[model samples]
Target: MSRERPIPSNGIVVLGASGMLGRAWRELLEELGINSRFLGRDECDITDAASIRRAIDGWPIVVNCAAYTDVDGAEAFEDEATRINGEAVAVLGAACIETGARLVHYSTDYVFNGQRDWAPATAPPYRTDEPRDPVNAYGRSKAVGESLLEPLIDSGKLDALIIRTSWVYAPWGKNFVLTIAKLASERDELTVVNDQYGRPTSALGLAETTLTLLENLVEPGIWHATDGGRCAWFDFATAIAEKTESGCVVKPCGSDQFPRPAKRPAFSVLDLSETEEVIGPMSPWEDRLDQVLIQAGLANKRRLRKARK
Candidate 1:
């Protein structure tokens, strides 16, 4: 709730403003009376150093939401993914270091391999310091980006904070929640993967948390930021169906049933102990989901009307 910040008066620069998270950040900033400049892919080619420099030249704070998020396509075009996700990030990091601007970069849970034998059954949420073993090309690319910034951050040359989040969905983007909501309304039965486990975070909540971190002047380091609690994709879908009154039956299916080009972590729930201690606790996923549904105009109006009867 605290809105005071450590940021400068120059205003924030947002990269990838056309994306889901970027849009959410823009909305949140406006609501909080903060000044920001948003740049889409056309305005700033992150992979090009000159373009990145032009975008963040005078800005004192930069929030990077751009990423090569095509998990399946990354298998065939790892080079493209690397250029955008890895190399581009390094370029941005270097530029931020040169300008002395605070950089808030986003990473993914895919950085870890699905096999967490350390806590097999209910695999404990991965800790921030845990070893990263990316299984697929997309994950590897993200890991490469994280590695590129490590030395700069360690040596106190770059003022940066990396936040690793999972299964992020927003009202305005192509995401799992929106997909499921649409499918449930049209289909009589829907099948979702039950083996995959992680928290579904709302982009709106994430944006608020990022602002809170800035307001508190939290230390520059890697942290996990997601809605509290976890569930399988199937469970998440069922919740969506129930909330929207879509009258669709959600069935659980094994991950092996539907193959994907990129191997996703079976259990990538991130440990939020450090994040909670530093920036306060996040709302439960169920609560955040309701808010998102209301914003998207997909809440269970039929159910509510029936109850009123």
Candidate 2:
């Protein structure tokens, strides 16, 4: 268990506050009664060091939710992705170090190369201590970000928590769940990749877990967080279809059938034993999805309330 610490009341600054994860983090912090501030890209350009320093000057804690997350798009634009994901992390870590502020940064399972195809489904989750060998351009960029931020942490100039997650979705924003739900509603049938396996994490749920750590001040290092179970994209889409009251039949297909410029991990299901031990267990993806859809007015309110509670 992580020992609790006093959270400075200088007001938390959420970088990329307008993004999906950033919005969820802001909402969760408000619910927790924490003083929070959100800075959008226009307000603070992460790529610009001066902008980041100015925005983080007063905050005692910083949560970096900004990143170029277009996985496939990153392949052709690795430099741009590196500028945002890699260089920005280094800049934030340095600023946090100088300001004596703690930083919580979000990462992805793409950091791990999915070389093992026979990983168990719904088995032991990925731990923070696991080996990481990213396969694609996006993964490489994130890996570089993690590496660059390590020095500040080792020097104790900054306290950092790196969270590696997968399949994050939310009510508003361009996520797999909303995207699949909309596709299903518009089409009669959908073909989703069934071969690639991972956890379907709700941005809201991830936000809650993130708040729990911040409020408790979980040990500064790396952590793995996601919903309770794991499944393929098809299964995740199927759940979204059921929640949104869509009639589309979700057909399972291999990743090869839907090849893109970037290569996705075939088995990136993370083991969350350490994370769950420190905080309470994460809710299943289906339950979280149902609640999100209800919040979005796409699901039955009464049933959703019951399931969430």
Candidate 3:
């Protein structure tokens, strides 16, 4: 389900320490007592080669979590997103190469178009070897980063791994779980898009699993990491509301009902075969969600209510 292993002796430096994923990494590293340094955007401007080089010079493992994560906003600021998710990655990769540091970078399932002519029942998960066919600007921007980094990895010029995950959530941060839980407490009814489906990855679990991968000495290339099982956004929302023990009624609706600038994939599930082969079966998404909610004390709502009475 969840795992942790010894990290490198030279220590790790985490970028994007201000973001949700970054904070998870920080927490995990601290728990493990691994010598680590976490840097936010203000401290480390990845777009600047000098800043990137300075950050990478001493660390043996470089974990990059920084990115322009706004999916809908990317439609309007594609260039800015590209500058961060794409161009900045190129610079960071170069710095890693120069410093001889192994890189661990995160990407999204959005890199795939999430459409197929085949029957939905039999459609296979997106393999690592699949071609890039993004449906939205955010996906395209991430695809650009993959394009720049894949060549380096294939050529054996850079020692790095790119992990593609979906619907990432953590105890702290602006994520689907917290959003739905909050709304369920305030509103009587909530509508979520039912057409979209993908696996959910717990940031805490992901951070630990990532360390486990490193402990196993996996190769430098693309890999998928998410909790086991798949579900639509509505299904996930319902699970969150239930976990929080809220009275909010969750309703399903098509994506068209709540339009946004970005065109999200109907199905963005990444193939976890390779990942599972390495780390064994992942914990089910519901189990992972429960663990996280409990950690955040959201699961204690009902207990607190009973205590109040």
| The candidate that achieves the highest TM-score relative to the unseen native structure | 1
Clash pairs, candidate 1, are none
TM-score of each: 0.95, 0.93, 0.95
Clashes of each: 0, 4, 0
Candidate 1 wrong stretches, greater than 4 Å? 118-121, 300-309
Predicted candidate 2 versus true structure: per-residue lDDT over 1-309, tens digit per residue: 232654687768999999999989888778867788899999999999999999999888898999999999999999999999999899889888888888989999999877663555644555677777999999999988998887777777779999889988888899887788789889999999988888888898897787677768677888888998788888888878866768889999988899899999788888788788878688887788787887777789786566447
> What tens-digit string does per-residue lDDT give for candidate 3 at 1-309?
334555667899999999999999999989888899999998898888888887878899999999999999999999999999999998899889988999999999999998966554357888998998999999999999989999999999999999999999999999999889999999999999998889999999899878878877799999989888888899999988876879899999999999999999988888999988988998889888888888898897556446336
Q: What residue runs in model 3 are displaced by over 4 Å at the alpha carbon?
A: 1-5, 118-122, 301-309
In the predicted model 3, the residue pairs found to clash are none
Q: Least lDDT summed over 10 consecutive residues: which range in candidate 1?
A: 300-309
Candidate 1 structure lDDT? 0.89
* Lowest-sum lDDT 10-residue window in model 2: 117-126
Candidate 1 lDDT over residue span 150-230, tens digit each: 888988999898999999999888999999999999999999999888889999999888878877887887988999988
RMSD for all candidates, in order, please. 2.3, 2.4, 3.1
Global lDDT scores for all candidate models? 0.89, 0.84, 0.89
